[model samples]
Target: MKNISMKNVVMGSVLAIAAVTSLSANATPVCSGTVAGNGASFSAGTNFVKVAFTPKCSANVFLDGEETSPTVFRVGSASLKGKTKFGGSSVGGSVGNMGACTGAGGVCSGTDSAAAMTAASS
Candidate 1:
């Protein structure tokens, strides 16, 4: 009976480890590339800020953004190929403005242009 209990514990541990490994394998890849013609515009109808940009990457990637705090905006996710565009909205105010922008996927960065309604990745 003791041996059976120990075996059950070992099997449970193995299953847990396998589950973690599977999750890591399916994790989304980061975005890496140069951003060009990146810009943002506010839509009064939807009360959300719309962002558009073209990332020059070797492979396709996913891009996402949200309002982190107040007027701050953060963009993240996998690498990109061809053209990519995403929108972000703020929860604090009626008018949404992208005060800052960022990127993910290894070493990635971005700049926010509130005046010109544009953003660029670096």
Candidate 2:
């Protein structure tokens, strides 16, 4: 009886895990297209950058970039100044790490295999 109970518990746990994984996998929506007019704002105190762009897949989307290292910038705002192609699933309105940012006229770029998108500012 104990063996059967343990088997049931293991099976239940596996099924619960699978269900959670499936739900998470399906939560992200696929998005693709060209993005333009990339721009970013940096908050030095928090080490956080916010990037905004016009995406063909949706209206203007803002993505967040958190920097691990301290960032130096003469200006808090930067113009990404170019267009790039993006194809991938969007999580919380961002296509993977598409907007990892740099400051002081630096470029932002990233690629995510799960989202299948690459983004760069020129």
The candidate maximizing lDDT is 1
User: Compared with the true structure, what per-residue lDDT tens digits does model 2 show for residues 6-120?
Assistant: 3233223223222222111112221211243322322223322233222122112222222232231110111122122122211223221233234334332222211222221
Q: What is the C-alpha lDDT of each candidate?
A: 0.26, 0.23
* Alpha carbon lDDT at 6, candidate 2: 31
Evaluate model 2: give its TM-score: 0.19
| Model 1 ranges off by over 4 Å | 1-59, 68-70, 80-122
TM-score of each: 0.21, 0.19
Candidate 1: worst-modelled 10 consecutive residues by lDDT: 21-30
